[model samples]
Target chain A: MINLPWPSGLLAQAAPAEVDYIANSWLGIASYLIAAALFILSLKWLSHPRTARRGVRAGEIGMTIAVIGTLLIYRAVSYKWIFIGMVVGSLIGAPMAVWMPMTAVPQRTALSHAFGALAAALVGTAHYYTLYGDAAIDRFTMAILAVEVLLGSLTFTGSLVAFGKLQELVPSSIKGLPNQNAINFSILGAALVVGIWLTASPMQHWLFPILIILGLAFGLCLVIPIGGADMPTVISLLNSYAGLSASLMGFVLDNYLLIIAGALDGSSGLILSIVMCKAMNRSFTNVLFGRMEPSAGGTSDDIYAGKVKSATPEDVAMLLEGAQRVIFVPGYGLAVAQAQHTVRELATELERNGCTIEYAIHPVAGRMPGHMNVLLAEADVPYDQLKEMDEINPTFAQCDVAIVIGANDVVNPLARTDPNSPIAGMPILNVDQARNVVVIKRSLSPGFAGIPNPLFAADNCLMLFGDGKKALIELVAAMKEG
Target chain B: MHNLEPKLFTFLLATFLGLEVIRRVSPLLHTPLMSLTNAISAISVVAAIQVMSEGHTTFNHVLCTLGVIAAMTNIIGGFWITDRMLKMFRREKPRRD
Candidate 1:
């Protein structure tokens, strides 16, 4: 068990009266301050791509220093067990970092939140156990501990459910026990009661396990009803939960750095969640309780029986020769086909053909907020050419052509034309306003919202049926030959 | 209990400061921002280390060990994964030839 005397040996010899104690304590404080400074800088640098790599470096160094500082505090104690834990963690973390695909970043993030929250909860649980009934443990610390455990436990399971939905381990459709919302709320209520009771009566330790169980159940229930289409928001929300849990764990531990860092994480996550919801024209309550997309409507057979106007790559290239301005709108289909690089190459080729090319990015265009931007950025697309929805929506009409590349709902005119549409009221890229529109997709299928797009029927629209990357490559070749 | 005031003050300050920082981030960087923030929240590693180092009994040791493992996984995995993603999001394109 790696047993070592706590109050004896080095601890007794290095007691507060000794010079070593003062030196060690001062060193610890200095390390913490430096680490905190690095973390703040990292967050600031993370706001832009140019400095983001340096930001990651700063965070890594700060975390390393924090780990070292903690190890120094308990230097007198045997670290056999701690080292073992560190080894096990690295074993899992390294593969996940190296082997995970870029498309699965959202799910990876969810899993990270799950682990982080579970750590905070476990720490609070351990602290309460170690100091059980100790008169020195005050009510405020207990209350914070209760908060830490509650958030940690909920985020732990909530993030797991989110990960499952994103990975399609469990069906992404809404599945919940009867009276799911009511049951979830009652469980949360019960946990809060137990937490308060524990705060008031430290001796009544029997309530601790019950509180943990309820919180975990609440987390599972919270994310189970959310479908995969809303994974981005749910993942962000779970991140906020994990952050708040860490912040409260800081209070219980009297660690200011943890408090600040956790608060930063929590607040930013909440803001991102709100932004995602707003982009979808939905509220937090609706996102949490409402079904993602109603499945009541099927694609109308009459609309696409023979109405889809298919075009060849050569035809699109010929059309591009006359076009002076073109805007490319991308969505999840682009991501699915991994066509970002090919698309960028096509844009470059079009630019060379004496045409203006710009990207129109909807906030919720891909699976996550800014998913298309990341994919485009990876292909080294000029940042200036990448335009947000509001910035490009008005400019579409001035363009000669709008290239809708593997995108559906974002360019669907039904959002504005049909009030009863599932995606109604959601802001969309105005590709329909352009003089001519070209869509590169495999088929005239319904998008994530399960609604058929009427933009396909517009007289000015042309559908180029094929894989996104393959179609774009062919178009690029056609342009080169001409 | 008496230390509540300072803790609450720090909490409020952190909250406002965090929101202000988030407001400045462009929509283009939201996914990276989410991942980066996920990495930073691994600050619980500080508490996890302390817990493992301080626990006296076998039960305390085992429980704290689990916490340490989880916290380390979060810190290491979160930071490394974010770095890998950001590295791929450069502004320079690869050689065409």
Candidate 2:
């Protein structure tokens, strides 16, 4: 019986131990409600580019409240372990968020999903351990816990592998993958069978670890065959898995809040995955098994290197000076270089010079969907000035100068010309149809899909090589000088 | 000041963290995430309803009804919002093509 300090006469008649416990409990609950409100507000605010930063802050507040509540509720031998966990998580997470290059944003997103999955899995495991050897625990509870743990672990490992692939730590596309679909299906089937077995015999705890392993393997199999281009879909699918795991864990623990939150996450993740699939004009099944290997015997370097012609900033500036209509195509490169402000400045200058400037946005530009929009909006680019691919493709033909910044596959002509190309038949921005094209890029590197674009080598195209941010600033300066 | 209070606190904290994760990832996932989170937040409805059905004080009953309504709004509103967003993504077939 631990003695609790409370206001005098508040709980004088009650046992000191119970009084203290109750007070602490109430404190915890109050924190949780506050956190929930913040969470809801954060999500609502995040929907638009205007409030995204605020949304991030709100989310942080909620997470802080949650961490505080968790620490207060759990009786530990010492606070050392809790502090250590917090410190370590922050040390790793902070650098990853700030220092990580925008080029590696996809991998970073995947890693974040893995962290989320790991947290859910850890919670589920802790719940199981807390109830270990309790015969009174029902079968349904055990089954839910097992499922949560399995899915959580699977999502964790799968997201890590995705991160690896996206980071180019692993090859972007692997070839000679015959009957990959059969292999993926077989693994999934085995995982399901093992999951059933684990649920049937919770007393045999060894099956729990085996189920986790099977799930892990299944996640790897599911993601490994997927091309780098399809990473957005894969990340979304893993997010769903993580959410489902959390929901199942909530059910096991009879926590209504957990169940609600987890289910929401899972369903949304699923929907997003479907949306990404649609954006790519690919089905979910095709995303999983479709291995779009670069053409055999044609190295990535061979396809892009020396084939393209370069232009100076002065040349690009002169080209822009005479152009009546300039269409800007922004891609991941713009985001990586954090060139939104510079791009916006250039647009403002162009507009001031009486050049009709319009931005062309592809559905699948940048690492995430709406990435360009968010970046552009941050730089105060007008919403009406940004045109979707379908709306602007026809207008490009009449434009005098098409300025492509860090965009490759989305603007590539190979998608239309090469029958064997992985990106074949995908509708691309018709920047090629423009009178003169100025491609701003850091280097002649292939896109995430590892496919070399022939548009850079086209007679109409002049590659302006430099960091997107630097190039845009120089372009703005040159325009001002002219 | 009760055991349940601490549980509530934990729930709130977890909810906030979960929401942040959703927010950061939402641009990638789109409106479906919002709809899903809305559904998850709706769990308060179940809690409210269960408390009400248990035949607690009249205050509890009122609270429960409010919870249910909030949850229903989240579910119905979420789906409606998602449907609207999906409509935005739809490509109109070119007349020539």
Error of 1 at A48 (Å): 2.2
- For each candidate, report its DockQ versus the true two-chain complex: 0.58, 0.05
Where model 1 places Cα greater than 4 Å from the true spot, the runs are A1-19, A133-137, A175-178, A292-307, A477-482, B92-97
Residue-pair clashes, model 1: 0
Q: Residue-wise lDDT of candidate 1 within A82-112, one digit each (tens)? A: 8888889888887878888766777777888
Q: Say which docking band candidate 2 falls in.
A: incorrect
User: Which portions of model 2 show Cα errors greater than 4 Å?
Assistant: A1-30, A70-79, A293-316, A333-352, A373-398, A412-427, A432-435, A440-482, B1-97
**Cα DockQ of the candidate 2 complex:** 0.05
Which candidate number has the best DockQ? Answer: 1
Candidate 2, residues A94-152: lDDT per residue as tens digits?
45544544345456557656766665555555444434433334566676677777787
Top candidate when judged by lDDT against the true structure: 1
- Residue A459 of candidate 1: its Cα lDDT? 88
Deviation of model 2 at B75, angstroms: 26
Question: What's the lDDT for residue A458 in model 1?
Answer: 81
